[model samples]
Target: MDGRPSFLIGGGQAADAIARIDWAATPLGPIGQWPQSLKTALSMMLLSSFPKAIAWGRELTTFHNDAFAPILGDKPQALGRPFSEVWVEVWPEIQPMVEKAFAGEATFIENFKLTIDRHGYPEEAYFTFCYSPIRAENGEVGGMMDTVMETTETVLAQRQLAVTNAELSHRMRNALAMVGAIATMSLRHATGLDEARRQLSQRLAALGRTQSFLSGEAAEDAHIYELIEQSFSAHPNLRQRIDVVGADFRLGSNQALALSLALNELITNSIKYGALSKPEGRIGIRWDCAGFRFVWREAGISGVEAPSREGFGSKVLMQFVPASFSGQARMRYESDGLIYELEAPAAAIDNT
Candidate 1:
């Protein structure tokens, strides 16, 4: 012995492991025989707060610090093992980088993916790290030092946010197009400028209500009964005049929007001229199935007749809304009242 105290005398757990290593049985030989350059590098790595490790000599004996131990996970024995064995799970992916470092070319990778067997099972991980050559006294690259930081959480969060932003942009474009269509149709059907303005404003407000409901974080598929109830929430007395009966089911986002718009048109017409135009009139709405089959019935009104010309409300209820779901709609204007029926596949309304 050189009669010197151990190099790791007051170091942390990783340093203590290195001190207990049987250096004489290893390719690196005894600590007393270690080169001054290797000793200096090890001393610096042992004191680092950042996760770091040194792979020394031709054998690439692994040595790391307390901060780096958790990175090894279940493989605590990695402290004195060969670097190749300690990280065998990702050797194929990292071998080229390690070889480059050994050749005196430093390598830096960000958000690098590796499937590692670190927690007693294989799991994917992302990292940002650098591998730089460690030189000997003769100025030759004899080993490599790794400084690493895990970036898995940060990378995943950014990716998720990007997806959400893309979806929102698409929805916004669709909404603007719908608004343009509603304005054009409303103006064409109005008898005068004031009538056009009033009709446009009412339709826009209806669109706004539907959007508000869908914008909620907890909003997913909407319940059929809840959607109908929401449409009449503004008119408490109207609730008593409306009879809703059917097995309730959820409507997908697009389906909910279409149905809400159609109902708004129907309700508006009824309150102005149809069944709900008189105190004695009443309305009944019913639906069923995964693919909804709906019926709207109005009664207690007399001299009901089909309009001479189809307007925006007629096209929305009898054509556009039905076509959107690849379904069919029918309307009958009997002398007693107007009855509307729509049939579409449940798949059209299933948001999930």
Candidate 2:
């Protein structure tokens, strides 16, 4: 061995350590005497980045770092153990899967849920795993390989978003119903036939605007202040007598329409019997959302009482509104004026 090291330069301890070393008994002596290229190729194949394992015959198997160890759980009696012994709990299910993979075929599982006592504790895990046959020199399947990826987070997020959206839709529908009722009722009590027709037209126009905003057909979201202003815009005489106080917030189509109609009725009622009836009377409107409840209340109507008959506006507000959006509305007669309130969930406000 001259001055050079006794070990071959290219076949040093470090190089051998990095390569896949197999000690299986083959027909041609031990497997180590296979051609140098064949041995190197096999080493590279096993040591590749892919999570890989070779399941030999019906029991024993070996796998690489990126694949085997991470999924082994806490069984110290795992490596070199029979496949059935290592995965006893799932062997019933894994048996058929492994058999199919070894029959020279590949199988894929998408979005599969699995629970196991992998680390000595039971936990649910979701994984997409695949089984493929590992081929021999003559292209015959000699063993099987396994591969996987996790999708638990993505699945959970999607479910949560869906639930929230459904809640929102229900709320929005109720709000729209409330608005429609108010508009219709207000038109019913106009001073004369001509006045009633004119009020109906105006209310219809306001309803259209509310609908457009909630449906996203409008370029901008419907701000509560803007909606209040629009509702009052139709009544210049009562405009100065009204005050709207609240932080600006957006409403979906259903919510916008509900508020729009409700405001229309409140303002109209004030004009006919509340503060608008008295030159010095003033109407105050306020609203906000807390704990998922949307609250709207109006004050400053004087000596009000529930009408003996159900008017067009009352029907729309009482029946249509609640059924449409799944919400409730109440009107109370106070000496100073009328107070009306609506309550529902935030989801009714998300048109999206």
Candidate 3:
């Protein structure tokens, strides 16, 4: 090399490395012998703040700027190496693009996918880049220059956003369908206009309350204990009268909504006629972890009887609530008080 060639003067580490390396040992022989085209291309590439690389001469010798180092990651030394061999893992996917550049065709692509193994493990990556031909003094295509920027994180983020939007749309439709069903059942089961108006208003209010208390994953997961607390929020006076017995455990969005609604119905009935109506009456809610059983037991009431006709509240407690967790429910009305029991696998209520 002639002391410090003019074309190798300004670029940081890349310039230093290119000037310091013994070019006589590489395929291009010596730096003094390098074509003006290669020298000019290297000078411009090395000076750029953006990531850039050039594959010059017959060997397709690689030369890159300091900004391009991170893209190589923990790969083998790439400076002064053949571009194709330097990225052999992804060469099969990118070779055609390289060929296009050398054939005097410049190509610009966005978010191009390439699976590479630069850090000892295969990973999918994306990049937006332009590969343009470099011309020799004779006007022949001498090599190619790559101007690139990795877009892996941006691409993945966009895909995740799409998925989240789709899930929100699906959840919204399901909630609307549930609201429609609740309205229909509430109006159908009412014995009188006054009862229908009260029932519909209360049921809708309970549904709104369910949305307020649930927390965690996708805004739908919650503890069984929390569901109970929220259900009893409207009846602070009766809360002390009722006894809660259960292990606190998380339930999915569906289970949380169903259980809270069921508990709300039970509370409404109790306030109007069952345990909460009489001062001495008491209520107990027990959920066993060993076998997965949720039992609601009432005590200290008389003349409790099955409803003359099924209501939306009954359907929620006896059918929809248990069915949400892939289980069965039974409701019993003895002369003393009402009883509701539901059984299902723990897995059914926990899976998100």
TM-score of each: 0.87, 0.51, 0.88
Report the lDDT tens digits of candidate 1 across residue range 219-291. Answer: 5458778889878866778899999999877777677888888999999988887898888889999987856
Which candidate ranks first by TM-score, i.e. highest?
Answer: 3
Between which residue pairs do clashes occur in model 1? 252-349, 290-346, 291-345, 291-346
Candidate with better lDDT, 1 vs 3: 3
State each model's C-alpha RMSD to the native. Answer: 3.3, 8.9, 2.9
Better of 1 and 2 by TM-score: 1
- Give a tens-digit lDDT track for model 2, residues 174-210: 5466446545565656667787777777667767656
Which is better, 1 or 3, measured by TM-score? 3
Clashes of each: 4, 22, 0
Candidate 1 residues lying further than 4 Å off, grouped into runs, are 1-13, 16-25, 29-33, 217-220, 300-303, 347-349
